[model samples]
Structures are given as C-alpha cells and as structure tokens.
Target: MEKKQLFRNSVFILFFLCAAFTVSAQVRVSDFRYIDNIEGYWTMKTKLGLYAEKWKRVDDHTWKGRTMRLQNGDSSKVDDMRLFLEGDGIYFTIAAVRDSVGEPIRFKLRVLKAVGFVAENLQSPYPQKITYRWKDTKHMDAHFEGKDGRVSREIIIQYTRQ
Candidate 1:
C-alpha cells in the first residue's frame, strides 16, 4: 500500500511539472505584436514568381496589408488583408483586392511573439496555418501550411524588409 501511494505521488509531481513548463513556454497576448513590427514594403523572389507585400499600421491593434504579384517591375494586387490584435488573441482578415471588398474572413491567432507569430483558419482551404518567423535581423519568412484530408501543402516566402 505504501509503495502504491509513493508511485501515485511521483506521477502527480511529474504531471504538475510538465504542465507548468508548457504554460511557461507558450506565447502570450503581450507578445502579439509580431505583425505590427513588420509594417513596411517587402518583396520575395521564388521559383514560382516574384511577390510583393506591403504592410501599413492602421492602429495600435490593427494593420492593413496587401500582397501582389510583380512582373516587369509592375505590381498586380492579389489579396487585401488585415491583422488585428484584440481580446486574448489576434486575427487575420481578408476582404478584397480588385473590385469590391466583401465580408472579411478572420483567422484567429494561435501563436504569438514580438517578432514571430502564427494564425490559423480551420475553415480555409488553402492556408490553414499562417506563420511568420524571422530568419535573421533583415530576413523574415511567411509560411503557409494546410492539409486537406490526406493532401498537405506548404509555402514559405522569405521577405526582405525595405
């Protein structure tokens, strides 16, 4: 009986320690400014094509952004986007690009940091996970990954801040 009790106690302590470590390791709301810091013009060159992105700070809690395809130094706007930090998390919204702005689809932020973060939309088909990570002081990577059933795809675009 004594041996059984000691075993239970050890398991409880181990569980408690693990929980504490996990809580401490997770990113918090205070670290939600990852998108805010990247407010500027960025361009990426990939085998697919050359892409351009521009970020504008709308407010302390919001940012306006746009992604475009560049050909012969001319830009064709692709997606109109927004980043918002509110409540206990952050979100990304997509409204419009060319003609008319429609309803904004919001993707909730699941990861947060001062310089890197991740947001996800389970309802989206293409990019279910949007992660922004810094590769160096001047280079940043915007990664998009998702799995539709058994098919999974990922795209990583490295941006040089301008």
Candidate 2:
C-alpha cells in the first residue's frame, strides 16, 4: 500500500511540473500591442521614387499590409506583407508582388518594445535584419541591414504617416 501511494505522488508531481512548464512557455497575442501603431498608411520619398505602405489589422493576432510605388499620380503594388502570431513567437513576412515563384521570407521577432521591434532572418542573403522604430506619433524609421560578401550594407528610410 505504501509503495502504491509513493508512485501516485510521483505521478502527480510530474504532471504538475509539465502543466506549469507549458503555461510558462505559452505566449499571448495581446502582449505585442506596440505593433498596433503600424496600422494606417505611411509614405516616404526617395530620389528614385515615392513609396508607400498601408497596414490593416486583420484581427488581434494578425496584420496585413502592402507596399506601393507611386508615380505620375498612380500607385502600383510592389510587395505584400504580413505580421502574425504563431506558436510561441510573432513573425513578419514579405514578398515581392512580381515574384510568383519565390516564397515569402519569414523574419522572426527578436526584440519588441513600446518604441519598436526588430526582426531577423538569418537565411536571407540580403537585408537579413529589419528594424522599425517609432520616432513620434506621425513619424517612423525603418532600417534594413545585411552583409553583402565582406561589406556591410544598410538602407534607412524615414516615413511619415499619411
């Protein structure tokens, strides 16, 4: 009888520990509220052309967006983008609108805060790291950084809410 009781106690303790670990590992979608600020249209002008991005919240756990190239009073779609929560992490994914044969690259969120977040894809050959920072209510900055061979390259863009 004592041996049976000891085995039962051990089983209960093991089950309790597994439940606790699972709860601690779970991530809630609501924890990333800072990303909500990205919703809306943002525009930036470069010497080459004017570009814009529009983001819309699909639900509490997802945002869908697209990049547009503006010229001659018209806009053309350049890329499709999305942010979503999966498993225990959030991911940012983007792909060129014209690249029908290529898969959208996925970047896992590495850091998140009230000001901004950083996402990275080590498998991507170029622009492996993407960072977004909020400068103010109406302004934001994005940086794309990667190594081209032995040379490091970075593109920085400042965007204004439109």
Please report the candidate that would top TM-score against the real structure: 2
Task: State the C-alpha lDDT per candidate.
Answer: 0.77, 0.82
Candidate 2 to truth, TM: 0.75
| TM-scores of the candidates in the order shown | 0.73, 0.75
Shift in Å, residue 128, candidate 2: 0.7
Off by over 4 Å in 1: 1-27, 47-49, 96-102
RMSD of 1: 5.0
lDDT of 1 by residue, 35-76 (tens): 666778888887767897888998888888899998776768
The prediction achieving the highest lDDT against the true structure is: 2
Worst 10 residues of 2 by lDDT: 94-103
lDDT of 1: 0.77
Candidate 2, superposed: residue stretches over 4 Å from native: 1-29, 97-101
What is the lDDT, from 0 to 100, of the residue 26 in candidate 2? 43
